[model samples]
Target: MRPIPHPGRPGKLLRLLAEKYPTKEAVMSRLIYLQGQLVLPKGVEHFMSDLHGEYAAFYHILNNCSGVIREKVDYVFGARMSKEEKAEFCTLIYYPKEKIEQMTAARRATPAWYRENIARCLALARLMSWKYPASRLPGLIPARLRPVLVELLATRPEADAAQLAYQQRLLASIVQADAGAEFLEDFASLVKRLAVAEFHFVGDFFDRGGRPDAILDRVMALPEVDIEWGNHDVLWMGAALGSPACIATVVRNSLRYDNVDVLERGYGISLRPLVTFAQHLYPDEAPIRAAERAATILLFKVEGALIERNPDLGMANRRLLHCIDFRNVCAVLPSGRYELRKAYFPTIDEDAVDPYVLTLEEREILDGLVTSFTESPSLRRHVDFLYRKGSLYLVRNGNLLFHGCVPLTEDGAFCEITYDGKKYAGRAWLDFCDQMARAAYLYHEQEALDFMYFLWCGRLSPLSGREVRTFERTFLADKTTWEEPADPYYRLLDDEETCERVLKEFGLSPKKGHIINGHVPVKVKKGESPVKAGGRAIIIDGGFCKAYHEKTGISGFTLISNSRGLRLLAHQKIADVRTALADNGDIESVSETVELATIHTTVGDTDKGRAMQEEITDLYNLLLAYQNGVLKPQA
Candidate 1:
């Protein structure tokens, strides 16, 4: 009757209303009112808890609320909430206590991979500590004594009375064997005097020759020494850390040394020392510790500045050094012995030559030169003949030297000339030449063509029969100019200016000291013929790497200086070191075979052993084409 006082009233009203109007609409309206009452109270509770309680209570309340209400409420709450409040809410809802705790514990536990890495690092550190104690005391001992110290420590660890006597004898032998003047004796005296200070090898104390681990042991003995990153060192560290790229680099470097077994065995053994060290030193934070250990190992492999002085040696040893520094597992233990002196090389500023211009043919010719001279036992005796009779000259000073011509006058100093009949000079020529050199080392086919063009033309030119003739003419003309110039030599002027500029840029002064460089071969048949026409630059190349007088050996001149006037040390050669070392199980036959195969393929030749000689011709042609941009890839 009175609308039953609405369906949602008291129980009596509801019964009366149902009797009067039991329609679906009336029932729905009553249900809605009941739902509103339930939700309204719950919503108020959620809001109250979220505002007053910390994040934990807020989240609990949110969870208990109905999904629909919670979503709407969240949006409203977010609008009025402070940043800190919002963050707290997020933390509570997204990260429960249990989950947070689990994550914290998991992070604390070092991963298996990381633990292994730390072990490797510690091994390297130990090696340095044991071998090069002088390294720990920086600025106390001169750089020259540090290497000697490493060698002594490596050979003798116990410091027994007998061992000390043996070390003295050994030092004498080393001094006698060394072609260097009394420098070794001076260095030894210095070491004894400066024994109080720790010596450190900042970089590259090991790798490349043989007995890498042994060398490492010697370096690692140093207590005060630390290491920095070198390109080669980085590679080894990366490889030890299980970096794929580093592994690939290791594999590549192994090819150069022809020591696949050594690579594998050394890598394994090197890792052993590191693992032991990490476990011993950093038992808790193994992974991070392992990384540091690996890094330390790499630091010992840093190549010294001596490498920069000997470009040929640097090229030949790059892969080996890289492997040792980056991928090889050579570990060293330090032994306190003799101190080592650091060797310094004077930097020269020459045009940056293009490596691509160096082609396989050019490299082959250079290698042939080195091989012929070095291989011949008699060549060492006749080195003077090669210089005086063979149109070679030996010129050098204490600090910096070069084999090419120096500028005759300042006017022609920065002038650019075509190197391979190409229409570029200065930086372009240098870049092109460097590129060629790189290609040759990599055994690229086009390296030959580039080489020929560079030799025949003053610059790179298009590859064609007609162009070849033109290039030859230009080359001949240039050569004639070089030979017949009476007043001023162009090349010498360019070289001197370039060198001056480089020294200035590096904050070095030419007047600081002497500089020695060798590239152009000396004339053995001519006596004391001037290598450079008018520049201050000196030439000491002396055809050391080339065949002279049918001799097979590698020859090199030494520069020795003190208070006395600068003098050129006689040229010396070592015969078949590569073959001897490689054959004595230092390098695997299979590795050599693989390298040869790789070289053949890269040079676009399908040949083995005997047929290898024919590839040289093709390499020459390809180099020329590349220089002229006739090669499609321009490589």
Candidate 2:
């Protein structure tokens, strides 16, 4: 039947919908389903920040969904299942492929066992996915397996005889098709995905630990995620975009931590050029330590080269080469004149106009490094993912999320800084910086590259809120010079008014939202609090790296936002994942409720809810047009 469009309907959009819906029935069916979904509990989100590589810990936490599996196991089986049984079940959920392989190889699990395990996992997944609408589950499941999974999960308890018979026939078919193990593995993944509806990686997925790319591999596969770029993350980002200053810093750190393989092997970058140049520059090296020191000197030269070319970098303080008294092997630094340690001056030619100038070989090596960073497919792909799913900061579900400070002055005002001849601070400034990051990658512009380096180390940068003190930390004997002053934002973080102002600046309601931050490791053992501003802001970087364990007193933390409320999962330090798993120890976890909702939060209260509401309104209008003869219904 020919129907008239609604008087208020947007023409082009309705036309698009008309082709898909054909008639009002399709749109009405979807609207009815979506409306019902709005009443369901909002899915839980698992938040982790400052991952800093630590692949074992990150991978285990991700696979386990930050102890969500254990909690679910307890909820599903409780005392009925022995501790041993529960532990094995958790293992299956975490390493389904590996566990299945072991069992199959050992002939420990027969076909009957696989069927029983698969059935049990499917049953438990039903409870885990209870919050998500049934329609959504099919999307998480593999297409070929979806029908079997849906049928098994939908089996009614009342129809025991028929359900058992149907289940038996399905199990037989699955076994015959050799899909029993694959089915179990897929079901286990479904449980993990359902348990953690979204992964919010607040920031810092690089440096300080090994195997960051492993986590990156998993993060790319996640259905929903948003990464707030931390200082370290930006450093890598800048390097990946071919910034020599950032590349040098990355090399120095990677060499210092014995993780250059992460850059060379993992990212398919060749550091052999740099090694050859460093060897040529400083010949009489003291073996291993000399290689490290010589490599660091190469980095200094590269960094200095950039600063010399562009004084706008404002890195006069970083001109440490000028302080080098080549003859005496001592430095007259500003803090205090002191002799240098391991004072080697093979590359510093005092007679030269530019001491930071790279040799022909060094330049060649740098060119190679830049090519590796810019041309490698994997490196390009990872950085592209960062651009696609990352932001300087994220404002979601009434909460403000940023990796570092809001960059406040001593008096608790936004510390303004100039960018591209315009002064920027607060939200507008952050947006501008984020835009520059996109421009940096998209256009490969020099100013964008320079800005990316600045974002990595600029003291006034919101991402890097403190003095880097790289030179001082490296060579100076005076501990005083090594002290990098914190931005005034840290002091103001405890002030309610400041928090409110900051929240309002980000266009979030001060009364309704909280600030979630990660940058500095929270010193939980020193009587310091991660929760500040009377719980209006929270810091979740609980020293994910082993390096910070003694200083911050925990391995890491996960901030969970579920239907019930927000909670913090403080994890006990984990030294080894395999040992912990074998012992059924998943980082002794303690959960503390942050703020419980008055009533459990439903999908109706989310940003997604607003989207669904708009869909409902549109569907209703479309239905109205169909009934009122305002628009022609598609045949």
The regions of model 2 sitting more than 4 angstroms off are 1-10, 104-107, 172-178, 283-288, 308-315, 333-336, 573-577
Query: What TM-score should be assigned to candidate 1?
Result: 0.24
lDDT of 1 at 452: 23
| lDDT (tens digit, per residue) of candidate 2 on 474-552 | 7766677778888899888999999999999988999778999898889999988888888899999999988998998
Best by TM-score: 2
Error of 1 at 583 (Å): 23
Error of 1 at 454 (Å): 3.8
Model 1 spans with C-alpha error above 4 angstroms: 1-133, 136-411, 417-508, 513-515, 529-535, 549-556, 560-567, 572-635
User: How would you encode candidate 1's per-residue C-alpha lDDT over 110-227 as one tens digit per residue?
Assistant: 3332222222212222332321223343343346655644455445425587875765565555535541123322332233222211221111211233233333433244332222
Report clashes for each candidate as comma-separated counts: 153, 7
lDDT, candidates in the order shown: 0.29, 0.81
